[model samples]
Target: MASVSALAQVDATPRVSAAVTMEQARMVDIRSLVPDISQSIAYAGSNNFVGAPIRGYQAPRCWLKHEAAEALARVDAALRERHMRLRVFDCYRPVRAVAHFVRWANDRADQRSKATHYPDLDKSKLLGDYIAPVSGHSRGATVDLTVLRCDAHDVDCEPLDMGTGFDFFGIRAHTDSPEVNAAQRANRHLLRDAMEAQGFRNYAMEWWHYTLRLEPTPDTLYDIPVTAPTDSGRQAEIERLMQPYDGDVPGVSLLVLKDGKVVLSRSYGRSDLERGIEASPATGYRLASVTKQFTAAAILLLAQDGKLAIDDPVKRWLPSLPKVADGITLRNLLDHTSGMLDYEDLMAAPYEGQIRDAGVLALLEKEDRLYFPPGSSFRYSNSGYALLALVAERASGKSFPEYLRTRIFQPLGMRDTLAYVAGGPEVPHRAWGYSKACDGWTRTDQNAYSAVLGDGGIYSNIADMARWAAALDDDRLLGKASRALAFERQAQVSSTPEATWYGFGWRLADGLQWHSGESVGFRNTIVRWPKQRLTVVVLSNRNDPTPYDLAISIGRWFMADAQAEPH
Candidate 1:
């Protein structure tokens, strides 16, 4: 989460979208609307607020029509009179996220998290109960909110104890549920009264939902277009184009892919700082956590060569590593169950000298308490992956970058993708990564950790990602078994449903296997829905969560297009 100070009253986005002709009705670009309605966060942070950091929490990443937002805010004001205000859960959800929700709602395989949230509700009927056949927020006219009350000064909001939490899907979340306590009932009423008073309507089952009496942009929800911008290009353009829309972001970038045709893609504002460059399918940008997939692929390739085993204990490689719970295996390290301390946090604690993988391990040794036993649960750990990079180095007699060059990157003909740095040959058509600092659209300080290959360090474009996806699916990289394992449910997370399935390095969301990468200067996610033969790849150099939601919306549009076809 970002270190937030007091902010002023409701901020509205001010932007003048470059004209979109009627034939090309501009779709909602979530990143463009992030400033107005998002909670502030540090770049590449774990801003879960509720769970283990929400995987996709970028803002200005989305937009709600002006009238719809104002109506919702007025309702929020009404609740304020009752010493309550609507604490928004989500607004202007991206089309991509809606697609993800649909896919998850249809996932009949697991009824586990549902059981935990709604013990009284039948698991088989959740789609009808919680999932909407179509989402209203996609129209940008609805919002999700909960009632919170505190001192008149707007401090310490005590959210009423509703039977179910914000994202919970069950009868308990119903506004007039007889199963709830008086306090819960009162809370639900306050929420409903506030919204209903302001020309809004509530969804009976969810107390947190309300739709604007009128949608401002009816019949015009946009499908974010694809582009390739260096992180610098997006940051610069967002300030100007989004300024009319008043976009405020920590950072952002555009993706460019060549070869594996992009039927459609995403971009923000203009890529050229001087409004010179137009992002294309082949623009190369920094690949933050996306680097992990490459790192994981490299390891699998090593394993295929009989150099390392997935089951090998990490201690076997990094012998000097501080001791952790004995059960933690190499797989745990790769899968993020190692229970080692997050090396980033450890590096921050009154440390000495330049921090490296060894320093990180020392901190983990100091804090060996496990969130859960290895293989029993999953928690994302950059430290775990970083160690794998080192392990690859030790096991194979080459640097991590060199190993990838000789083994994975080179073999697959991913000529453009590399662990790029400042001194390298000027990256062709490279989009610069930028931030809206006190200055403006200035290049972001290159991520200190960008040099590390495991967590985030590789750099490529849309073209490279498409190549990666194709290889993972049908290429002769590591055989079909290795690719299958990459997309399967490897870890069973208790509270985190979307990421329950994590293979080697990919996070499985619905039927789509994907992972989101965020860093000081870039945020990106690529989902390959093999079942549907769809690939939604969104790469932004901005360190915000907007791209994840944006990618999901793009997926929905494609699915809709497919279903409406004459075939």
Candidate 2:
């Protein structure tokens, strides 16, 4: 759990006070130390894993201890003599910024940066190797940088291709990975040589990362803000939006996107009732069946890559599946027309602990039957999405989460979303799920099959959902054709006056495309009025009273004249 002080100050930079020690005062801005050095602080922008400006990094300027900055200046001069210069990507990361990384790494569901940074590895594997609670950079002695060719006055230069981009979390980014060509290898050597000559040592796992051998303040971790200060009056809007959730129970984090811009973002109620932790915009809520669209998107992404056809039979990948499933195609699975038995219902009465995606297949194999012929009818089946997840993994040679992270989340910059799994990293600012009890609110965070992904088991917040909503409207991830397939009516699953048509993972009725999720102690709904360029995401941590109604009521605010018939 994050400290209240830390959480409260996340958006604010640390200011120097009279009590500051002389050693702390020695910290100097890198620009003042080396006026000519090029800097591009990734965390200060949306380029980092968090997909937003990191906590404490209010500005893009680099800061470092005086001694370390002087050493870096010397290295820059030496590189300039060789008609090259050092361009710093990151320097003097704050302790708060490192805490933000820890929170992100623990969130199994937030893989938006996995593709660009760690496509081949799971987010859980990044904790010890690529990310840690404590970093040398926080001590003001480490820097992430690349080499750039320069001309007179250091203008009109090109960055040397070092095989992999900075902050890439794979073997290719290693100092000696044997994956890069000779030219890229030489470039890495050149950067390392200059830094090492100035008493810096390269981290073996990252070519662009280096720490001074004799750090100026090895024992100190600064909490200074990275960006200059400013005041924004948006807090009033946030407070107003949170007015309804002014109670002791768990709350909701919401975001409204109109015309690709976030007009509202707010949080309410308690994140952890037992700890008396108030919910904030950072709190993550289990998305439940809201995860279905992501699973469907993964299948679509695989199809786009030509790794597998949507019409390919389920057995094409899962050879062990029973003959009954042979008629089921990947498209059938995406659209919930596979007729596969619900794995949740098949689980034993007492309920086994948590079943993973693999366990879902194993259970399905034991049953040698289908509810209906594949693609002939529509019935929402958690089993179909689970199988789709398997197909995606097999087709892409990556886990379901990894594929979504690399292909969808990262591409769209939805940094705070992920298909969560048990034993994975902790969800930062996590809103503990709760249910109404005779006595009071009771913790009901996980169900018997909470670990099973695909159909559900994702966790996210409204800030990230805004990005996701934007992607659905554009051809950023899926092409125009694929997007059409995702939203097109595939089966008339319901025929009543208040009926819904089923698409890949969305429920279509009139001009509205939406989905709702209900788990042990969470309820969520996301509604997109694409024609109006409006999206409303309501994520609640309480199980009672599903959020679909609230989402519909909110949607009316944006769709008064163009309100579509409701389901």
| Best-fitting candidate, scored by TM-score | 2
What does candidate 2's lDDT look like per residue over 1-567, in tens digits? 111111111223433233133244466766565644555565765656677778977666667778888999999989888878767788877778888888888899987878887889988888877777667777677788888775454433457888987778788988888999999999999999999999998887888888888875566567777753122333333333443453345778777788889977766566677754546556788988999999888888778888988899889999899989889888888888888999988888887588888999999999999999888889889888888888888888888888888888888887767777666656656778888887568999987878878889778878788888888888888888889999999988788877789888899998889999999999899998888888989889888778777777666665663455474
lDDT at position 219, candidate 2: 62
Candidate 1 lDDT over residue span 289-323, tens digit each? 87888878777777778998888888888776655
Per-prediction TM-score:
0.53, 0.57
Q: For each candidate in the order shown, give its overall lDDT on alpha carbons.
A: 0.58, 0.76
